[model samples]
Target: MGVQKEKLVQVPRIENGIGLMAGFDIRVIQEFADESLRATSQDDIVEKFRKESRQFGFDYFVALSLCDLADPPEDVVWVDQSPKGWDQIYIKNDFQNVDPYFAAAVKQRLPFVWSDCLDRVQRSKGVAQPTHDMLDEAASFGYGDGISIPMLIPGTHRGCVSLTGERPDLSQGPRHTIHLMAIYLFEACLRINKSALREWKAKEFIALTDREKHTLQLLGSGLNASDISEVLKVSEPTVRYYIKNAKQKLGANNVTHAVAKAMLYGHIEI
Candidate 1:
């Protein structure tokens, strides 16, 4: 997904004020940011982000460049890693038109949850019933809970990073960590060569066997090991073996990350 062509007001520059930011570990955040900046490829950035973010229980991540609302940039960056079916549902329903988080990202410079922004929007001026209904539908697709962090970078359009899960660590500490991690990760993604990204990912595809690729595709489609075993006509342990091999080959920390990498890079499709 990328920026919409519609023209809007530009986001104002704001400084990150001082605070204890007690909820997150500064050391971990620093390490993650450093690692992200050093990443040579988009895949490497996503891998590092997934490894750190999953610790807080998030299942998906999306970063969008809300390029200078005054004028859509020539090149807009959008990165989405989510569960199966959610993307199709989002696009089919056109949720972006009514999404409050997008507005909040442009106007505010802080991290906020979906409900927080919805409530604020409702209080200022009531939104249509469709907004509520759209969110309800999103929850059914595993975006039951989520947080959005505004990414304010100079000389570029405003950006936002959103993470979703059934129940994620949204406490102050984890929020701080996630906020910093997302900012650096998005910046790193912006610096990569967008056109060459596919070629880089394609190079990795040669390492995955057909069975491993199939296993990841099924995993991305929301099947458990047992279900995949039945469908593949193999034992549960065999399914796990395939997953483990795929993870190692992909340099992923777990099955979910492996599946995300495979799906994001076009190694497999659900």
Candidate 2:
């Protein structure tokens, strides 16, 4: 239900020759971070981020927020600025389920390099073929190398902003700077997207009936339909009806998705 993942590491800048350039780039990261935070639109933020990425050496990118991947790939909001052809193929192939980067994000707590995805592929049995194929196809699009930064905004849904294609000389400076940039880009877009969504009327969002709300609350808390029926002294089918109605009201794809949407829209607290 999250974005990119990898354990990001920051090491000392002690290289006599290369350290200078790395130091300069690392410091400039703060400058971009400032600009990103104040960005009001997805386009502006992505434009600035892409320009900066080229300066550091990268081509394609994907900024995504996955609230619950169990639903469908298109269920979450994502900023996909990668090549046009890649998007079509990727979505058509249903590759998200097998993408190593996404799998890593679910388990990893740190930003990771592209190679880390391969490492994950190697560790998982029978998964190597799909991972390899995905990478092989991505390489055809010139996105053979890049960085993945899984973003976590406390109390918010998990997200990721990634830079793909071309390699940035890691020895140039603190790798954490890359992670920081990825996070800033994702967050800027999040704010812009959310601002539009925040205009939704609270009354319309919480259209569920009292019974529906209670049913959803219990469901979100991990109670099953049968349990809820017993607790409410209603038939199992009646409980299902309420849950189904709540899912429709929330525009959710499943039980978990409905729960997440209810929480996000302030309809219910979990």
For every candidate in turn, the CA RMSD to the true structure comes to: 17.1, 13.9
For residue 172, model 2's alpha carbon misses the true position, in angstroms, by: 5.7
Off-target runs (Cα >4 Å) in candidate 1 are 1-23, 67-74, 194-270
lDDT of 2 by residue, 2-93 (tens): 48565577875777665564435655788888988888877887888777776666778888885443353432447888887887787777
Alpha carbon RMSD to native, model 1: 17.1
Off by over 4 Å in 2: 1-26, 67-77, 123-127, 172-174, 200-270
Clash list (residue pairs), candidate 1:
23-173, 24-173, 68-157
- How do the residues 1-270 of candidate 1 rate in per-residue lDDT, one tens digit apiece? 357766686885665755456557778788887887788788888878887888888889888787433344545567778778776776777766777887687788889987777777889998888788877887887775778998887866678899988888888777878888998988888777444555575555548888889989999989999999999999999999999998998789988889887876678877
Candidate 1 Cα deviation (angstroms), residue 237: 67
Worst 10 residues of 2 by lDDT: 67-76
TM-score, prediction 2? 0.61
